[model samples]
Target: MNQLKVELIVDNRVNRSTLSGNGIRNAVSLQPVLYVGGIPNNNHINLTGSGLNAYGFQGCLSSFIVDGRLLDYQRALVLN
Candidate 1:
């Protein structure tokens, strides 16, 4: 099986607000689901999403799992 590394660039303040927000309130603004799919190579893979902004999120990617299995991964961004 191959592992996929997911990256998320979320607003730190918004994420914190959401974490602290009760069910009635929403923290950061809701973003569309981000999907990255591609062949795996080396230790990293390039990803693209439909709704992703040109300026990616600064926060770390969390809750990442591949095929129901969890693994440690990192992101190295290449700006174009």
Candidate 2:
């Protein structure tokens, strides 16, 4: 299975020795949403970047746990 892991730790300061070999982007990011891609909405053509690209997530999210708590993305989507 092709897998990729991205761990973001929000901390003040910690021992760097404990850090793993994972791709650790040490500096905090200003734009939280690093990657952005979506289908164009013809209805809202006035909106900027509406017809950008179609590269949104395309796979089943088996699991998404944050702080040891499993999140309900499907339910959230329906609510919104």
Give the winner by TM-score.
2
Report the C-alpha lDDT of model 1 over 1-80, residue by residue, as the tens digit.
22223343344333211122122111122232223442224423222322222343344566555446554444413321
lDDT of 1 at 19: 23
In the predicted model 1, the residue pairs found to clash are 9-57
Q: Of the candidates shown, which would achieve the greatest lDDT relative to the real structure? A: 2
Candidate 2 per-residue lDDT, tens place, 1-80, comes to 22223453334332222222223332112233233234345422122222223346554555555557776778856864
Superposed model 2: Cα runs more than 4 Å off: 1-5, 8-55
Model 2: which ten-residue window has the lowest total lDDT?
21-30
Q: Supply the global lDDT for candidate 1.
A: 0.32
Candidate 1 regions with alpha-carbon error over 4 angstroms: 1-49, 74-80
TM-scores of all models? 0.21, 0.28
Q: lDDT of each prediction vs. the true structure? A: 0.32, 0.38
